[model samples]
Target: MSLIDNINKAFDHRIRLGIMSILMVNDYADFNMLKELLGATDGNLASHTKALEKEDYIKVEKQFIGRKPNTRYSTTPLGKKEFQKHIDALEKLIGK
Candidate 1:
């Protein structure tokens, strides 16, 4: 298997890709923020985030702001490296 195969596996769905892309730039973003950005349902985002977290691809921090609890996401150092590699793999696939 090649590198693209790895990235392809990482982002099997476009929703997953969108999630990672958003987390790449920002240091941290909450569940609501991600849902707003991706236009995804809570269940949808939660499921995908759980998948990434299981893979050790993203770090999740849960805390409360005022009275309500929030889940914030940020790419782990390992995740950051993997995402960059994924991008490079995509560029290769595009013949760049």
Candidate 2:
């Protein structure tokens, strides 16, 4: 298969890519942390996260922190596998 074929469409957007990249290293990240790291607005981040969630690439957890709501995100096993494939494909394409 072609290198391009290994790239996942779900991670096409920069925000989604950033999210996955962060999750790859961290156990989990909360909404504010992701927003700060990705420099995405609330709506933009929410949309991209929802897209990832729909693709089953990320798992979302909603809870209350002393009466305040909090949302955390982490990558699923499938997500990690697919994202690694995407990175490998990019590396191959770049001759790295």
Candidate 3:
């Protein structure tokens, strides 16, 4: 068996995984962008992000844009590493 063959360990939370998936395709994503893309509620996204933050997998930048609160999220180097591992495991499982 491969080192990262365990899906549960590789991707525990679907929302967080989805967040990483989207960020993989984009340079950065704002709070609303992730919410709309993942169809996750504010609290849901917030909680999931906290989880990733605890793991240092993602970085959150909070500030204001034109007097409106804006939050941007980007995957970290560690996040990219884990995400790529997850993708590889998934692809292997799918035999692709």
lDDT tens string, model 1, 1-96? 575475658766877888899999999989998999899998988999999998898999999899999889999998888888888888887889
- Point to the candidate with the largest lDDT: 2
Question: How good is model 2 by TM-score?
Answer: 0.97
User: Candidate 3 versus the native: TM-score?
Assistant: 0.88
The CA lDDT of each predicted structure is 0.86, 0.95, 0.84
For all predicted structures, in order, the TM-scores are 0.91, 0.97, 0.88
Judged by lDDT against the true structure, how good is candidate 3?
0.84
The CA-based lDDT of model 1 is what?
0.86
Candidate 3 per-residue lDDT over residues 1-96, each given as its tens digit: 764455545357789789989888888899998999889999998989888888888888999899999999888999888888788878888889
Rank ordering of all candidates by lDDT, starting from the highest:
2, 1, 3
Span of 10 residues, lowest total lDDT, candidate 2: 1-10
- Give candidate 1's error at residue 7 in angstroms: 2.9
